[model samples]
Target: MRRWFMHLGALVLAGGAAAQSPLAEFDPADFGKVVIQPRQSTSGAGGIAFEQAFGNYQNEPVIAYGEGSQAVRLGRPVGRLDMLFEDGSTGFCTAFIVDDTHLLTNYHCIPGLPRDGVQPQVKAAQFVAGYIRPGHGEGVDRYTVAPNAVEADRALDYAVLEVFGDPSQTYGRLELAGVDPEDGEFLWIIGHPQGQSQHISREGCAASSPAVSGEGKLMHTCDTLGGNSGSPVLRLSDKRVVALHHAGDSRTGYNMAIPMARILAVSKFLKGAEGLPAAAPAPLPEVPAGACDALWAEAKGQGCAGYGAYLASCGTHAFAGLARNLQASDCGTAAPAVIHGALTVKPSGGDFPTLAEAVQRAPYGARVSVWPGVYSGPVYVTKDIEITGAGPRDQIVIDGVMHWSRGRGAVRGLTLRQGVAVDGGSLTLEDNVITSPATGIALRGGDAVVRANLVQQTGEAGVSISSNGAVRVEANRITRSAHAGIEIRDGAAPEVFDNEISDGAQSGVYLHSGGGGVLRGNEIHHNAFHAISAKGAVKPVVRGNRLHSNGYDAVRLREGAGGTWEDNDLSGNRAGGFRVEPDAGNVLLRGNRE
Candidate 1:
């Protein structure tokens, strides 16, 4: 008795045209009808496989009998359930065996059963399992798990019941299917489909989709109704119970089952001592090439330990385990081996051979340990490498310059005397001291980030940004330079911020050649030229600065300089606070104290 609807043309109904096609008699009274379709083979298989398949899933069989119903058979009878309410009325529930001692059903199957949360509870409850056709009255047997120990995932609408009693009361255990069945596989459900222990059983083939009402790992068909909310949907191929029958589809002839895998994942039955099945083990991923060599290189007897720790101490290395593993490998005087993976390395030899060599040997996503020493070789890095000192006192010094042409790079927590230049890579230099060079750090292409570093005693500009490289220079101390302490040229957007520039031969900060930069939060004083000079510069934001004590004007904007000058404290300078000539447009000034 499945629900099927069809709409024909008005002509057939009015008998105005063509012959009348005989259709099934329509009845509004039989709104809830059950339909059983013939089984068909569906061959599609193998998407997400499972660990184990279900075995024989029947414990104690039950029988169903009613006025409108024919003879029905239940695979495993979830016997009488005891439903205790807050009003003191108790009713028996339908209980099905998942294993020897575990009972499976909907969480709402037994209302007012307080096993957890902040609720009042009693220690006593009744369970009834096995039932048979009495030939006259209700058949009865003992097939119940007691105490209903735990509940979980109430949002999933499922629950597990733990029966605590003698084992002789039950016959056998019910098995759960490991994976989803074929599309058209035969499915069966046995439960109290109308609050009657008449245990109705209906056989139907799996449908393409849910029957329109039920959802999430459910099947749509015309086979079930109320009181069957916690029944089992079993696959006959291996007698496996796949999903817990939760609800029926209202739109079409269908019912829904919660997959066994999800139940097994969150269930804690096997954790108890009541002879339940254990969970399947997890699968492992494939190992990479030279995995053993890489592992051995990170083992003890290596000389590279404190390098990663030092980087972490300076906020240079984001990942900490890489440093510990590099210290464990034995670099064998050739060079310090790179530490990749999750282990710790303790290098037994001296510091890394050279910064460049250390970078070349370390893994792609790892840090190289550079102990405190004067490293006088050129470091051309191509990957994201972190080079750090051994300790504050044991500093890692680079006596020579560094050159990077491609890829991205980062240099942190190390002092450099020679110069550093990046041509194509995105580079970042942080928390270091650069001295003696004409330019402390220079970038020509890609992007550059120079932050929290000291650039002092340079014959030329302390830091220079050129060659179209978008540069961000912030929170730095630049002093004692022959020319401008900081210079932006070659058509780049240079952000100069929060810096102290003093005692320079030329301007404290000089902007030229169409430089698009922001000059803010700077202390510019004691310079030969203007404290801050913007000549032929474009789009410069000059504000929030202490500009004074210079040989020329406190701030100078001339020669078509497109910039802003305001909110500045220009005090005790030789020339006027600001000297803005003609041809300077898009300039704004407000709230100044000179």
Candidate 2:
């Protein structure tokens, strides 16, 4: 049954009371922001553009299943799923149980999420049978996506995955149609829209265009939103799936879906060749010094492709001595640790009200504990001290720029806004949510530990450290950054691991111009370009990351960059798996799990 929690204007819990609520139950009429990667308008001239609303675009949103009591009447084929990934990243989308364990969703929804370098990274799939306001408390049932059970087509945009157990026993399965829906047929689109409850859109929505998208896709007028990516657009008469909802026009007139026939065909083909391995990792070949010298000289002129035949010529461990010879500067000098156990500047007892004020008042050897509230920043701390929050990270928010000027400072349990710049300090940032301006954590000339932080939507990088990249970025969830997730550039070399970085406009982790580092066990996927982009005379040890579902190469090297690349899961990328520009120096590649 659909559980109605409370109204938006007057939300009253059993004991607690909130004047306003964020739940969709109170305001279900408006859908949230569409989360798909925005595409260029097909609405312009000579584009596959669509414009003008096809039907009444301004209708009151109808609550699906009427608060869950009508679940018996509505078909049980469609439902909502919340995908949980390693590194504590989460996403929601729509899906339908197709077989005992098999399920259908858009490829974008589950792209490269199943594996973390041959290991299962997607931890669970929480299914909300009657996905209403989760705050009302009960209706979520979670199932794990089975390891190596993902099959997808990036171009066509459809995926078939197997759940850990049989969802068919509870939700039942949706039947597939081999036939196409006729244009103007009544299209009943049912799925969770905007991460709200399950919704059904039928007001003036119909199958309008046939094959308007890549082969056999149907364009319709079904109202959908971000979380509705994998919605099943069913024909009203029988409730069988006609198309799988994928993309929508931002102009509010049209949405696109892959036909059910195409999805079924792809599923059949994938059933046989699932978990296909990547090609054998090619190592640097054995060559005479003169030959290697000649190739390098030619590559400097023509490019790396000039010696393409010698994949990694110059012999294994060719650059090992060179990599070891480089020294970390005096910037690696040790700093004093922050003194703990002193309480100062809190909401109640301390002299100051804000975090910045507290840090300023506190001596070099004291600790500051802030209360649960939005603390304004430039919370610049120059003293070697510890700054903590009252409770969980979500409750204590620092709403401005945070900077650590002095070395050996610790910050915990705070959601920082704007961004943070730490230089000449050994700072530790943990359990904080940080959005960005330019870079989320700009660690210039600092040795820091950034652990378990949620960094998102940054301009330059999620974590951008300078020449002295003496930092450890681990277990952090970074997404939708304009540049690299962890940009170790200009001679910085940091240890980056266990981070889930996705949808980055540039490489997941970029190593540029004398930067050298180790990238291991990081789930780097769905980025616009390479998972790891190495440039200049840098040699990074890139290993054991799930580098897939990317637009370009899994790893890209240019100019004089080379590295040890091995044991990564590379598949389903738009371009070839890995590449090295002809001018790139010798790259030692071997034993990668493709």
Candidate 3:
């Protein structure tokens, strides 16, 4: 999540200190000096949900064996199987194998939807597993299940169906991944939408956060429609089904899936179902040996590099020991290759000893811990490495020096200053404070996660990612900048969540050139021009945010690009509650107020 602080000129708000001049409408062209009272509603979005029911069906090959009668049970043991009722009419829904005898679907898809908090009909359905058209499509298979014993969560808008049957024999079981995938991992959704295709699957990524409280999970991207209810969402990494699709806020094009962890928790609450035992924790794969040896070797090679003479130690034994202990503990195993060595600056070497040296010494997929102190120098890395503090509170300050250049790298828990450049690479800079820099962080690569940092007093944009994989920016404070607080270039899908961006020169959050992303659960206030600017950004979702006191439009959409603005309160922006430029596309503006 690359973000910046745009200058919104200061102004006075209702009940705030009286301005030197009388109150008047705000002018966005000169917003940098404005101040307004807090607005209502959280400005944020939701992401995908991971469900445990379809653990194996999500990621790996599945093989199950059972008869239609044994595969599922709905409304007593005997009734018409593979049929359901909806909205007082007989509407059909399909159920596939979540487990041998377990099914899943939308709570509303059940025969009896909760009407006025009471069941109007007996909530029951049937299951039909291994429905294959022999000879016509020998290899293609389909399964059906009706809701029999159903448990639903209206807030999450999903339900779990338990069928009666020996699933191992009736159908192919799937391999479920137990871990959440890294960003950029390929993901797929399988189900019927609009009653068009059977076993239809939608592909996306484990891309794009919330505050610490699951705002990110509520704001994810997926192409789903009304009929996608009860579909299983699988990750390509481990084939583990993680989420169950449910309700979505169409305005932001952000879909919500119930995470598997929650389903398991809820399932436990529904224990005592016949033939079902407590859900077992899924197992993760083992890490190979000598995975991080490259880092140690690289560090030694750098120590020998001719850099006016510097000494640093690189080894793996300590790291290996830690890995073994971690795997034995509750946190699970550590990737042996993910360990990184520490590099300390020689005394009087200035701030950051030499970021160039650290990069040269660290190997791909390794972590490099930096010892704290002030060092005036620029740094650059070309490999995948985690650069973090030796220990929290141990500061490595880079004053008046920018770490320019790039090639898939990460910087963590360090202070940076002017001259920092992030040209490319799988880049991530977190837990750092940046001040007075040409640009706080600039990215041209994909697959980045930037979080938990302070970026202020910069001469240029605070954070920018023009291209690459999904970018997620969360939990940061950006104030008083020369340029936009956060600039997301068009053609990149970024999720910006939970940041306090105030008092900047231009727009607080600017999306240009088709900035297709979601802005949810944040405070966008007191900016010079527009609080949120969607210039050529298509279908951006702006929700649950507090937007107040901007010079121009509180939220502006231009160039035929549209966004869904919902559940947000707009006030004192000196313009309309929401403004759409001429020729803008279908930008849904709902659930918002002035």
TM-score of 2: 0.45
Q: Write the per-residue lDDT of candidate 1 for residues 50-115, one digit (tens) a residue.
A: 100112222222443432121222243354344433433222234566554567676645332232
Q: Report every candidate's CA lDDT.
A: 0.55, 0.63, 0.50
Q: Rank candidates by lDDT, best first.
A: 2, 1, 3
lDDT of 3 by residue, 1-594 (tens): 322111011111213322221211122222211121111211112221212112122221111211221111110111112332332322333344545566655555553344335554433344433322211223323333444446776545456666665443334343333334444444566543322233334334343443012542433455544335566566543334555555444344455666655555555323211121112122223233343454434433553231111111222243433332333243332222333333343222222245556566554345455544455656655554566653222245666554434334567767776634555445676777877656676655645677888888888877775765657889888877678888888577788899888888887888888766778888877888888887764677888888888778888887877868899888778775688778677888788878
Displacement of the residue 543 alpha carbon in candidate 3, Å: 1.4
> Which regions of candidate 1 deviate over 4 angstroms?
1-348, 467-470, 583-586
Kindly state the number of residue pairs that clash in model 1: 36
* TM-score per candidate, chains pooled: 0.42, 0.45, 0.42
List the candidates ranked by TM-score, beginning with the highest: 2, 3, 1
The residue-level lDDT of candidate 2 at 168 comes to: 63
lDDT of 3: 0.50
